[model samples]
Target: MNREGINVDPQGRVAIVLVRARNPLNIGAAARAMSNFGFDDLRVVNDYDVPFAEARSAIDAAPVLAAARQFGSVADAIADCTLVFGTTALGDRRLQHPVELLRDAGPHAQAARMAGGTVAILFGSEKTGLSAEEMSHCHRLLTIPMHRGGVSMNLGQAVAVCLYELARDGAAPRTLPEEARPATAAELARYETLLREVLVTSEYDRRFPGNMGEDALRRLVRRLALQGDDVEVWLGMLRQVLWKLRQ
Candidate 1:
């Protein structure tokens, strides 16, 4: 039996995002892995050669490459997705997003997909990994297990490993009851904007300059995993504060 036919539900809802990858070959290889795992949605953020689809490594996955979408930034790429996971090696940097082992992330992705939500798994550039700004857009960070002294895996291999785990775990039936749909990236973005304006009005940034407080507050909001209603409530509360401050 073809694996494609077996696990078809989440294929369209899950996207593989490559951020500022420099090598066309690596992009091709990532596309090939998506082909192997039955995930077709590919979103590339920033400055990738258009001919990457024709790389020799892409092999029979040319179609996946041909249909890939390009975006200006991680935020634009994942605007439609309700759940976003950024893949990180987690070397030494302190991160705000909750870190989950790659093995354990599959169920979370699966649950989001089962709940009729789109999921985006982000793979950063091979050289620098995800920048702090890019990772902030993700709801969580996923790290593949490796030995303490192990060298970092190549970009394509990282995508393959994460997708394989997700595909494997996605075969299991969802056990959790349905709940309110999570807020979209755009919704959270709007909420962030309003909250920032409120903070500025309240002189929160003046007291704590360089936008440190604003950045921390953004991460805190993302970590909350707010739903649509939750976002609306927060937006309303913040807007009210902003309005009263003007009074």
Candidate 2:
């Protein structure tokens, strides 16, 4: 696979997500890094439009920059991804997800791509990193080891480091069939919404309010790890249950 260069199953299975990145130069550099590693799916979650526009206008900007898609939120940016990884600096913030070192995460990400899953790696802003709410969307978190004195990396540098590690593995075979594809984050989110409604309608929230927080329910559904076909069945069943409760 090294000879073939990033043997992704459906062409583009890896996406780089930037949440609240503010620097135009960093955005351009991030795009350049994606191009360097032969990745093109760049999703930016930024409300401000000027930085994205300026990055695209940069003279040395990569082609991926021109075609990058802008999203209003991290959830929307990563909705189509089947597996989401968030990069963190491991500061004093309390974490709710399991964390993996940067070196170890590449194989897992490559394996996800080989299984026909779209993998998304998210990078937070230049100032503060991913918010607690944004980090909750990830299945697992990845952290780059740093010297004791170093707190974090620059936005563009962090993007480059993560992509470099991922690109180092150029030999994994792309083998999964389309039918075997896992359910996307978008589908899982939709299922979560419906299930939440069912819980509300059935008075489960009132009876068992302990487990009804949005983050808790989201983690609960993700723990199921339903496949594409399974999510449809579950959605149908939940709909029926909701309807019956309403009646």
Candidate 3:
């Protein structure tokens, strides 16, 4: 894929992927990162798109926020792309390409651009990171070199690193497709309400009493990075479960 306009600053195409994220703050942080580095395309796969707005992040990047895309599967997110990469801290194991240095990735990205195909970098959930199944879709793997003995990166930081790397060098800047919009702050709020109703009806409150932490639970639901259809399925399941519980 090595040719021209690949991985250079302000001249290359870019896309972001969030897989099963469980924190809205991280999503907000990512939006801010996009604004800071001039990247707008973001792909999410979860039962609920992360409610980044409620956390008070990604202030000016609202345009990017509005354009975030929802996907039912990772395959859908990176399907048409000419190349795909996954980020991880677990690349010490044997794989086609272990975590490569940003320097190395630069050349690879440019090559893909030369080949004329969309390129994407994938990320996973905060809890367990990307699964082997997800990683299989990537052509390369990048592991941000963390400080010695440092904890793995929070969602925002990881995104900032990638966006910065791609934009700092001036990857060809461009607008993302309609398919790249993430969930808005308002949509997330509605999903949060639905999530709470589901939980409340399912007797989750009885298990925790009056201090059931509805707000916190709502926040948890808001941060999950789910797409519209994904949310529908989750709510349906919750409804069915709650219906049975009431019986």
- Judging by lDDT against the true structure, name the best candidate: 2
User: Which 10 consecutive positions of candidate 3 have the poorest summed lDDT?
Assistant: 1-10
Of the two candidates 1 and 2, the one with more favorable TM-score, higher being better, is 2
lDDT of 2 by residue, 1-247 (tens): 4655644432258999999889999999899888877789999999999999889988867889989999998889988888999888988889999899999887788788777789999898889988999999999999999998975688888888887787665633344356666889999999999999999988899999989999999999889878987889999999999889888
Error of 1 at 161 (Å): 0.6
- Model 1: runs farther than 4 Å from truth? 1-8, 48-61, 170-247
Deviation from native of the Cα of residue 188 in model 3, angstroms:
64
Q: Using Cα atoms with residue i matched to residue i, what is each candidate's TM-score against the true structure? A: 0.62, 0.65, 0.60
Model 3 per-residue lDDT tens digits across residues 41-84: 88787766445334334545466667888788999989778878
Error of 1 at 206 (Å): 99
Native-structure RMSD, model 3? 22.4
Q: How close is candidate 3 to the true structure, as a TM-score?
A: 0.60
Compared with the true structure, what per-residue lDDT tens digits does model 1 show for residues 1-247? 1244544464659999999888888888898898878888998886655545345335465678878888887889999999999988999899998999988887788778768899999999889999999999999999999999999999999988887777663443334567998999899889988978887888888887766565677787789899987888888888889999999
Shift of residue 8 alpha carbon in model 2, Å? 6.0
| Candidate 2 lDDT (Cα, 0 to 1) | 0.86
Off by over 4 Å in 3: 1-12, 49-61, 91-96, 171-247
Summing lDDT over every window of 10 consecutive residues in candidate 2, give the lowest-scoring window.
169-178
Worst 10 residues of 1 by lDDT: 1-10
